[model samples]
Each structure stands twice: as C-alpha cells, then as structure tokens.
Target: MSYRQKQLVMQYAEINNVLDFRLKPELKEALNNIHKQLRKLDDDRERIYLEYSQKLA
Candidate 1:
C-alpha cells in the first residue's frame, strides 16, 4: 500500500482499539472509506505486479 494508505490503516487500527465497542458514526464512515481506498490500492499493485511478471516470462 502507499504511504498515505498505510498511515490511514494505522490510524484506523488505533481508533478501533481506542474506541473498542463504541465508535462514533463519523469515524466509522472514515474507516470504511479508508478500507475502500486500501482495497483499490492493493488491487492496483497486484495488477501491476502481474503485468511485470508476465513481461519477464
């Protein structure tokens, strides 16, 4: 994942731990959005790696 994405993940984890079973609505929404971005970044990285490996083969 990208640097910003990594940071967001860390923040999300920290917030989750701190909030435990009581999370605010806005924070939950933000976490969901970050998760979406992280998924997209992961997909993009996988696609690029696949293309690179195919070129080598």
Candidate 2:
C-alpha cells in the first residue's frame, strides 16, 4: 500500500485500540435482543407461509 494509506490504517487501529468502540455490554445485549426478535419474526413468517400453502393445496 501507499505510505498515506498505511498511515491512515495505522491511525485507525490505534484509535480503535484506545476506544474499544464495539465492547459495550449494553450495546451487545441490545444487539442480541434484536437478533432474537428477528429470528422469531422469521420463524413466524415461515410457519404462516407453510400453513397457508397447506390450506391452499
């Protein structure tokens, strides 16, 4: 990579190490809850589709 690109990447890594932006417990829990809700919605969608398809057949 070019020198400027290398510098920018190194700067980003240093800032990330200092900040640790993705390591908050509340943020992680919120993400987990959203994931669970999405999974439930997907399951419900599949179940309803199957039920309707069976009825129409």
Candidate 1: segments with Cα more than 4 A from true spot: 20-23
Using TM-score, give the best candidate's number: 1
Candidate 2's C-alpha runs over 4 A off are 1-23
Indicate the worst ten consecutive residues by lDDT in candidate 1: 18-27
The superposed Cα distance between candidate 1 and the true structure at residue 33, in angstroms, equals 0.6
* Model 1 pairs whose backbones collide: none
Error of 1 at 15 (Å): 2.2
**What is the Cα-based lDDT of residue 51 in candidate 1?**
100
Name the lDDT of candidate 1.
0.80
**Candidate 2 per-residue C-alpha lDDT over 3-44 given as tens digits, one digit per residue, 9 for 90 to 100:** 544554555455445554466545455546555655666677
Per-residue alpha-carbon lDDT of candidate 1 for residues 1-57, written as tens digits (9 for 90 to 100): 578777978887876775554546677777788789888888899999999999999
Error of 1 at 1 (Å): 3.9
lDDT of each: 0.80, 0.60
